[model samples]
Structure formats: C-alpha cells, structure tokens
Target: MPRARGSGASAAAGGGGAGAGHGGGGRLSGAGPGGQKSARGTALPACLSVSAGCRSSARACREGGGRGLGRAVLPWPPLVASVGAGGGGGTRGWADTESVGKKRCVCLLTGAWLNGVMGRRLGKNKGALNELFSKAAGMLACIIRESAALTRDVLEQHFNDLKGTLKKLLDERLMSLLQEVDAIEQESIKPLDECQKLIEHGVSTADDLLREGESAVHGDVGQQNEKLCIFTKKALHIQLDSLPEVPSLVDVPCLSAQLDDCLLTILKNQIFRHGTVASRPPVQLEEFVEKPGGILVRWCKVDEDFIPQDYRLQYRKGTATHFEDVYIGSETEFVVLHIDPNVDYQFRVCARRDGRQEWSPWSIPQIGSTTLVPHEWTTGLEGYSLSSRRNIALRNDAQSCGVLYSKAPTYFCGQTLTFRIETVGQPDRRDSLGVCVEQQNGCDSLQRDKAVCISTNGAVFVNGKEMTNQLPAVTSGSTVTFDMEVVHLGTSSNEGGNFKLRVTISSNNREVVFDWVLDQCCGSLYFGCSFSYPGWKVLVF
Candidate 1:
C-alpha cells in the first residue's frame, strides 16, 4: 500500500507545486482511486499550505519511509478524503486513505500539465510581440530616412534657383552702373575739350600776328604803315573777351567725392532697395536712314514696372572722342541731323524714371552710316564738252568718249548712292552710266572694254562682258534715275571682304532691279557716266 504514483512526484521534484503551477491556485482536490467522488475538492500541497517547520518534518518522514525505494514522494497536508472501491464499514477507513492519496495525485498532475502548456504559450507570444515591435520600428525608421532625403533635395534645388536668380540680377545692375559711369565721364570732359580748343586757336593767331609784324619792317615806310593797320584791324576782330574760364584740376578731388556720393544715393534708391532686384534695359533701339544726312532712332521699353519718364540719346562720329547728346526728353525716338555722310557713327540711349535722379544704363551701341555725297566729277578727255549747272552736263564726242568719275570713295556697307540722268538727244547703247571699281589711275577714259558698268539700256556689263539682259530703255528727253546700295556679307576673308551691290534704274514708268556680288576691290570705287555718241547730252544730278 505504497503511495500511488502520479505526475505530482515529477512536478514536486522539478520545483513545482499545485499552488505555484496553476497561477497561484492554493487549493487541491481529493477523489477516489477509481475516479470516485471526493469528500473535499482539490487541496494545496503541503509545502505551500503548512508552515516551514511542518513542511520540513513531513519531508523528513517521507524520506525515512521511502529510503529503500529509488523514488521518494513528499507528504501532502492532512485533509479530508473520500472512499475507495473496497467499500464496507470496517474497510471504509482504509479506503478513504487510498482515495485521499489518489485525489492528491490527480490534482498535482493536472496543475503540472496546465503549467507546462501555459509556459510554452507565453514563450511563443513573447517572441511574436518582440518581432512585431521590431518590424514596426524598422518601418518607422525607413519612413523617417526617406522623408529626410526628400526634404534635403527640395531645399537644395530651391537654393540653387535662388542663387541663379541673384546672379542674374547682380549682373544687370552692374551693367547699368557701368553705363552711367561712361556717360558721366564723357560729360565731364566736354568743357575741358572746348577750353583746349580755344587756347590753341588763340596761340595760333598770336604767332601769325608776330610773323606779320616782322615782315612789315622790311617793306616801304608807307606800305609798312598800311600793312600794320591791316594786321591790327584783323587782330581786333578776333574777340577773346568772352572766353570761358579754364577749370582748375585741383577741384577734381571734390568733384569726385560728390560724384561718389551721388552714385551711392542712386544705388540705394534704385538697385539696393529693401525688396527689389535688377531689371533688364529697354528693348532694341532701332535706327532708320533719314534723308539729307540724318538718322532716326527709336526704342521701346519692355519692362512695364519700370516706366521711363524721359529718354536721352547720344551719338558720336567715327573719329570723335566724346558722344554728344542729341535729345533729352520724353520722346522714344529722335532725329539726329547734321551728321556727316558716309562717316561711321555710334549711338546709345538711356532712360530716366519719374522722380528718380539716376538714369538707366545705356542701351547697346548701334553703328550706322549716313548717305554718301558724291565727290566732284573728273574726266580725262579734253574735247568732251561739259556744262556746270546745279547738275553736270556731259556732251558726248565721237572721237573721244567722256568718262566722268568721283574723286573720293565711299564705304561699301550701309551706303546709298542716288543720281538722275536726263538725255537731251538720242543716245546709243554705247552710252552707259554706272559705278565702277578700278585702279585710281586706270579710270582716265571711257573704257567700256576694261570695267564694269550698267548701261542706260539696263544691261549689266561685267569686265566688258554682258552679265544680265534685263534693260530699261531711256528715250530722248527722258530722265533715268539710279539707286545703288552696297551690303556687307560677313567677315570671312573671301565672303566678309566681299560686298553685294543692288542697283535699281527707273525711267518712263519702266524699272529694272538687279544685284551683283563683287570681290574685295580694296580700293576706291567711282560713280560716273560714260558716253560715246556725239551731240547726245546727258545731265547728271
């Protein structure tokens, strides 16, 4: 009647008890050995239910009794019991003992089994929770990294655009400042130039007077007095009383300081204001050829925010050192007259804002030329009859044809030459009028065999060969007008150096137009008329 073997023994040996194993359930059940009902329910193990002394005594007694056996079971706490399978009045007591033992075994085994299952489940859940947290953390970290990268790229691109804009604005402002400085420099030197010219003139005149007085000393006495009086009167006529005072160079420092201050003020007001940047200059400043030695220049503003209140136009000749102001008012265009014909000129323009003292930078300089005025005509023939009126009349001779040519040559680019020829009598095909490019000394006679010419019949002859057959006829008493323009092609040695000549001839409602590409003659070209028929008079205007 040893104690029944059950899972309680294994659980107690592994440091587990009913109360500790079943999540701290302190009760134990007692049932019969054959699974009969128990008098009491599950009961707590002795180790957990009794005091320390009682647990030690019980363990000692169980060890002593079960020494011979290989396994030992600790005693349980005394509790009520149920009956065993052997039922009788006398055997009831023994039956109850067996039942008590069986019930304790069953309770211990159930507690241990439940504890093992719960432990495994808890371990699995712990691992799953840890994995979930790790995954969530990793996802959050990835999102943060991606967001940071995007933010950095966006900020970098924004800064780059801002930098480019700032650079553009700065360049525009610098160009404007440079233009203003150039204008100021030119204006400042004008008075000095005028004063120098006057001084030079006075010196030249004084030297002439001294030389005249010295020469008069050797003449006859009466003649000397008369010559002296004449020289004295000539000197008196040159009035120097109103000469402008020369500016002192010592004042340059003071003037420069004032200029710097003025420029600083303008910069602050126009360019360096709180929230403004630079702006572009006005749009294209165009120039057109005006009749009679003049040019018409015009411009338009593109920036609407910067409306100009006034415009200033300045121009200079090819050999000039300073630009002279041509117009300074609100007009967008101006006519600059008195320009020398066939001379190269450059023009610039600036605009002033309303209530602002500083003028905008000058526009890019435009280069152009005035219309050419033909030089006096020269001829080599002696028997050729000529008449000098407002226009020149050349009477043809049969023995010697007359060839009249200009003395000076004009530029091939941007030049227009116009003239009219009226025939008095019937003219043959041999009588021609056009422009030619030949050696200066080779143009002595009407040599149609050695030069290029456009005939009155509108045929173009190149080097004495007919190049074009389109001819406009000129009848007797009819006037033929010719207009020629020379255009530059480019700057290459073979192409840029060459020029294209456009010719238009009109007479009696008939007109002929043609263009010819000419090689670089590099010398002077002459505009002239040639005639061979006698009694045929041609008047050139």
Candidate 2:
C-alpha cells in the first residue's frame, strides 16, 4: 500500500509507533473515559471508512441522526452450529439480504411511522384516526406494550444470529493461521537442534586433547636424563600476521547504562592485561582487507559478572548473525566491530549476564555510513511559536526551520533540499529566532557566501542578496505550524563543512550563509531541529 510522509512533530514524539510507515498517524482516539461507548459500538466523532453493504452498521459512525444507530449485536459463543445455516454465502452482501419480500416489509413499517407522526390517516378521516391513536382506549399500550415488543423480538433474533455467525468465521480463520505457523516452526527448528549437538561434541573433543599434559605423548627415559634443547637465533626469521588496530571507544555508540561498568572491566582485562593461553591471546582482534567482493558481519555479547578470559567464544548453530556464538563470559554488555568496512552494514548487540538464559533485548540497530566526512542529523523542529505580532504576519516569518546534519565529514558540494520544521508554544517579545544554515569545515563556518536563511522579518536572502520569496503571516492562538518550503541552493565559491541550524535572536546573526549574517541565538522560540537522512548523495557535483 502507498504510505504518506510523516510530519516533523510525529518523529520527535516517539512514545508511540509514530513512524511515517507504521500504525496510525498519531491522531487522538475517540474513545471516552475507560473506553465507554458514546454510540452504537463506536464512539462518536471517530473516523471510520465505510464499505459497501454496511449502511445499518454505518449509521453508528454519525451523530444526531433519527433512528437509533444500529450496532452489530453478535450472538453467544457455541450458538452458531454451522456456517451453512447462516446463509451459504458470505455475511450481508447486497444480493443475499435485499430480496423483494424484505424490501416490502421495510417500506410498510417506515410508512406507518411517518403517517402516524404526521397526523395522517389511511382514508379520508386522517384527523379522527390520529386522535383515536393519541387518546383512545389504551392508546399508549397499542404502540409501546404491543407493537414495540414485536419489533424488538425480531431485531434481537436477527442480531443474535449474526453475532454467532461472525464468531464462527473468526474462529476458523484463526485456526488456519495457527496451523501454518506450526508447520513453519517444525521445518526451521528441527535441523537447527541437530547441528547444535554436533558443534558441542566437536568442542568437547578439542578441550579433552588440549587438557592432556605432554606426559601423555612423551616416553621419557627418566626425570634426571631428560634434556632441554636450546639453540642460537637462526639466520632465517619467520614472518607472521600483524596485530589489528584498536577501534575507538566512542565508535561503540550508545549502550544500555546498566551494562556500562561491566563492559569496562571486560575491555580492561582483554586489552590491558595481555593475558593468553597456549601461545594464543584470549581475545584477538584481526583486520584484513576483504577481497573486493562478498563480506560477512559479526556480533558478540557477554555476561555481566567477572568471567575467566579462557572462556570459548565460538559461533553456534541457529544463531545466524552472531559471530563467535559463544556468550562472552557473564559480562552484561557487548561490543560490536565492523570486521569489513568496504560494504554498507548494520549490527545488533544483545547480552545476558550470570547464567541467565533469556537474552536481554537487542540494542537498536546501528548503521555504518560509508561517507568519509562526519555529520549529525537532528530530531527535526517542533512546538514553536511566533513571539511578536509583527512576526506572525507571514508564513516564512512565523515559521521555524529544523536542524539537518551531514552524514559525511564535510559537505564539499552545494545542493538544495527542503527542511520540514514543526512548532507549538506561546509567543512573546523576548522569544526571538531565525533559521541558520551554513557549512562547518571544522571549527570555522565555511562557505558563508552560498548559504540560505529565513527570519521573522519575512525576508529570505542568499549570498547577502535578497531572494524573491517572502514569509507569510501567522494567526493568533495557533499552536502547530510548518514552513511551505525552503531550499539551500549552493554556489560555486563555497563548499565542504558541517551544517548546523541554530535558533537565535536576530541581533546575534554571525554565521553568514552565503554572506548573510544570522547574528542571534534565540532559545525561547527553540523547540528542536529535524535531521536529514545523510550527507551522501545530498551534495551533487
């Protein structure tokens, strides 16, 4: 199905599944307190798209209509014995229930009610009949006690029957889905168990051999006669692989705070202690240039408590993505490394400490961007307001621009892209603000000449020259607002640097995008900034 792009406010409000592609678009639900009913099965004011042959049920979607909204009154479970009795065809299609006989019965009932309410009669004495029905002997009993009972009986029976039929249909559907899932589980898991057993056997055998002392292989004459050979250094030297470079600690990304202390201890012992057994280090980090072709990714997790370094770290069956499938000795934290850097990649880290078989939830997936330049994306702009009545006079003037980071280390080429900003708050005189877009080449804000900016004054300028577009006016008491569109069209003179959008007052405009000074850093109007996807493919030659 086609999907709509999400708004900036939606992403920052991350408590719900408000992503652009999943779940509802963050709209408020119409349910009342404790989910009380406001109308027939549905709360009033709820948005529902009606399908064909759903008129009776559809009436509940609206309010203030005459005739009570007909709710889908379902029957008791175990009431519907068979689908065949509930009309062989599917539920309530136009052809199944709209026969000539049914139509006549409905019309007759409708006419009777209209005639009685309008004070009309079947023949010439309309007035007399109306007076008789209104005030004659037992007039109220005729309508309520007698007529209402029959109508209610018929409706109740039909509703009960339909309810039973729907329940049966859903039960059948669920059973089918469960069977399919069961088959899939059997097919995928049976072989995995067999493979795991074989791996365990091999490890056991290797451990036994390594445990045997040299005495098991050696037949010495006597302890005193035993000779130890020592030789001088040989002319020919052996060449071996060089050690892998240590990765930066910051490269690990944000991890669970609970695991921080435990992870530090593991890294200290493995890297700092230089402990090894059998002439091989307990932990080895090796790097090699992959043959410019297919590549592999690996993940490792450890238990929390102190674990012996000799613990085996080998891949196991059924674990498709993790390398060295062995759980790192009881360390509650995990560290991930990009064994191969040429390919685009992502990795997940999960850990469980102290013999806890249930693994902790996997950390958020982290993607490694291939760009040489480093940049950061913002959370997008949100909840902003215009301070003064003058600023509310225009679209560009009343709006807020969000922050976008370059994934690459630098933006070498200039390009134009739209930045979506969101905001809501009270406005005041001191709450000054403006949009700042410029290239950051290290400490200096480079390319001051080719930047673009918009401010409360409703003016847009690039390279110190005024642009054609002007800001729109704002309305009072408006909480949410967005920019129509703004672009950063790069020029030939300036290129390459980090870009940051600083919300500031007009007086402090210092970072000049295309030579237009954005002097202020107004924090009052500040909500936050929105980040772009990345720097790669953004800057074109």
- Most TM-score-accurate candidate: 1
Q: How close is candidate 1 to the true structure, as a TM-score?
A: 0.29
lDDT of each: 0.47, 0.26
lDDT of 2 by residue, 35-113 (tens): 1121123211111111123233223222212221111100000000000111122111110111111110011011222
1-541 in candidate 1: lDDT tens per residue? 1111111112122222111111011122211111111223333222211111223322332343221111111122221111111112221111111111112111222233223422233354445434433553454355446546765776678668877997999799879877877777888888888888988888787788878878787789989999888888977887645566887788532233223468668766864443322323443353233323455454555355777888888888875799888888887656565656666677777788889887775654555444434234554445355554223555655464456665444413222233445444555666666666753343433335435565656666655677645556655665554455544465663444556666655555565666656666333456666665655555443
Backbone clash pairs for candidate 1 read 27-43, 28-42, 28-43, 28-44, 29-41, 29-42, 29-43, 490-496
- Provide TM-scores for the models: 0.29, 0.17
Off by over 4 Å in 2: 1-374, 377-409, 414-418, 422-450, 456-458, 471-541
What is the clash count for each candidate, in the order shown?
Answer: 8, 55
Q: Determine which window of 10 residues in candidate 2 has minimal summed lDDT.
A: 73-82
